[model samples]
Target: MIRKTDLFSGVIILLGIAFYYWILGSYFPGKKIVLSALIILNGIGLMVHIKYFDSYKKGTYVTFMGYLATLGFVLITTALELLEIFK
Candidate 1:
């Protein structure tokens, strides 16, 4: 079962990202743009999960893990982008 707190937390996390980007609308190029798009898509997927979280019998652990995994992926990709690893 999904709680209200969980839904709020998920929405807040995504809104924060959107706000951050809104405040800093720097342009990206090539691979970086693709990576950023991927991150944004991941957030959209998470919102879908948050919306229908209670429908799944085993949603709690799966949802939390998905959140963490996406966080880790974004962190790693951001670091790589900052360090120009993909270039």
Candidate 2:
């Protein structure tokens, strides 16, 4: 059975991915900020989940994946910003 907290975490992760895709592919300033905020919040939620959900291996794996996703977002955004500056 999926706990409410776990379900919330999954929703957050999905939102983060959607935000990353939209921000990285388009030029929407508002969405960029919203997505960035969502990612940070999702990270926090994942950390909390990790601490409380010791029995769930899937939570650990998802948290790790979330960290990677956040890293990828930062790298892609940085590269894009640098490209703009250079041009």
Candidate 3:
């Protein structure tokens, strides 16, 4: 039987991809706020997965690392935009 945590992780991965596409495919009004909230949500979801599942599998690590990289890029871009706004 498949575990619920496994399903949840899969959903989170899908969400990250969907979020990426969503950002890419449209001109989001208030992009900063939306992306910032998404980043926070992803962080919280990761923490919850770690707390509950407690697995150190290699695949899981790689997947989460990829997600982090994507988030990091978004964060840097967002920061630059904020700087431009303030300047």
Candidate 4:
């Protein structure tokens, strides 16, 4: 069962991705700030989900894998931004 917070966070993440895609050809400071905030929120949501699983002692492996995947996503996204790959 996904919590409301998690669902909201997922929506934020999707919106952020869309915003980033939309702004790929145009550079704007405010858009960058919004993207960063959304990424951070997604990360926080991932952590919350992991913590919830840990507390319940269920699907620990899956949660750990999810954390790894989330970390990878963040790292890759940051690297691409730093490298200006989208620009």
Ranking 1 against 4 by TM-score, winner: 4
- Evaluate model 1: give its TM-score: 0.36
Please give, for residues 1-87, the per-residue lDDT of candidate 3 as tens digits.
655655655665565566656764456578667666656655666565557543433457776675455445545544543453344
Worst 10 residues of 2 by lDDT: 78-87
Identify the leading candidate in terms of lDDT: 4
- lDDT against the true structure, each candidate: 0.53, 0.56, 0.56, 0.57
Better of 1 and 4 by lDDT: 4
Task: For candidate 1, write residues 11-81 as lDDT tens digits.
Answer: 54564465346423444455466555555655655575556545543656776676666555545544543
The TM-scores, one per candidate, come to: 0.36, 0.50, 0.47, 0.46
Q: For model 1, what is the alpha-carbon lDDT of residue 4?
A: 62
- Candidate 2: regions farther than 4 A off: 57-87
Which window of 10 residues has the lowest lDDT sum in candidate 4?
Answer: 78-87
lDDT of 1 at 21: 62
Model 3 residue 32 CA deviation in Å: 2.6
lDDT for model 1: 0.53
Q: Which is the better candidate, 3 or 4, if ranked by lDDT?
A: 4
